[model samples]
Target: MAVSAIATPVAASSGSFLISPNVGLMLWTLILFGISMFVLWKLAFPRISEALDRRQRAIEESIDAAERTREESRELLEEYRERLREARSQAEEIIERARRTAEVHERDTQAEAQARREQLMEQTRREIATETRRAIDEIRREVADLTVMATEKVTRKTLTEEDQRRLVEEALGELDFSALAPAREE
Candidate 1:
């Protein structure tokens, strides 16, 4: 019926009311638009705006939480890196200390070996000197015995112990026995 009423006016006017404006229709359209806008503002607009505000708050909170988490992770990474660097430095120090200890040990060992070798050489020299003195004494005794026997044969008689001793001493004094001994090294 309302469509017929609107159509009747267009039929009577013979010109479209959309082309030539109708004051009554324009007034009713304005009233209806205002009422609809008022209803939406009171009901739908508040709900939509509240939903949009909730979504914005949620997104901002999520972003802030993510930023905090990122900062914490960065700090943890830096701490891990620092610990690694300290570990590497400690390892290097340990290696260096070990090397120094080994070097010191080697030097001490070499010194001890050298000292032992020198001691052995000195002992050998002392033994050689003792043996040389013993041999010279034995040779002197043999020469003294031979001289007494030769004198007994030449004189056709045994001599007294005092005379034999004097002859052996004179013979020993005339002999240069130092050349027969081994040479000493400095």
Candidate 2:
């Protein structure tokens, strides 16, 4: 029995490296390995691979959605900037229009004031002319009365109406009206 066991070990070694002489054990091990591979291909491995593929697809969808969101945010930012620029332009235009309106109103106010001043000046001139004319007329009447009295005293008698009128006319012709009234400055 010991010699037979030794011969079997030698024959097994001569055949191949790491080979055993127990055929039944090797056959049983091969059958168990095959069953494990079939079970993995049909059930466990397929389920695990499906789970991994589903996770990969989900990741790809999430990345695509993130890219779309980024694009949309960029467009919105540009749109908001354009709106802000338009608002600023409108504000500047409004300010400019208000300034122009104020200038026109100021000019109109100045023109009205100038016209009123001119009207007041013209009225004053008319009043002064009327007063001057009245003064001159009063002086003429008093001078005529004095001349008539002087003549009557010199003659030692009251003169007739005709003689008084003739003497008053002579006095008025000798008087210079330009000397009594001053020239007006333009």
Candidate 3:
């Protein structure tokens, strides 16, 4: 009935933006639309929807893989940073240890030098003392010999061994031996 109403043209012209449909034409158009809808539902629509679903899943999986890769890269970066920090700290510790070792070596070297200097000084002092004793003994011998010669000249006779020994003893007794020797600290 609606198709018949649209197909019947009005004798009076109305100011409306409408076109009348022909009855036979509207009936054939409906038949063609139904056939096309049936064919698409049976074959084309199912394949198109399946393809769209597969494409959507593929896109989602790609996004997930990208996210995983980004997370792994972040973890690697943090690990590398930690290793760098450790290496720097270890280097600092090694440098500090080397400095401490150098300090110890310097102190040991200085102490050893000082000890060697003291030992050398002591040895020199001992050598001087020995030389002084030898010089003093030589001088005493010379004085004793001169005194014996003078006594023999004065008496106008050669002095015997006994007389020479007695004269040397008297001269040695008169002198202070302690005063000629070096003073000891201890």
Best by lDDT: 1
Cα lDDT computed for each candidate against the true fold? 0.90, 0.85, 0.87
Model 2 gets an lDDT of 0.85
Clash counts per candidate, in order, are: 0, 0, 0
Task: Give the winner by TM-score: 1 or 3.
Answer: 3
Winner of 1 and 2 under TM-score: 1
Query: Residue 25, candidate 3: how far off, in angstroms?
Result: 17
Model 2, 76-161: lDDT tens per residue?
Answer: 99999999999999999999999999999999999999999998988888888778888888888988998888888889888888
- Please list the residue runs of candidate 1 whose C-alpha ends up more than 4 Å from where it truly belongs after superposition: 1-13, 130-174
TM-score of each model, in listed order: 0.59, 0.55, 0.63
The lowest-lDDT stretch of 10 consecutive residues in candidate 2 is 12-21
Query: Per-residue alpha-carbon lDDT of model 3 for 61-139, expressed as tens digits?
Result: 9999999999999999999999999999999999999999999999999999999999999999989899889988987
**Candidate 3 CA-lDDT value:** 0.87
Whose TM-score is greatest here?
3
lDDT of 2 at 63: 99
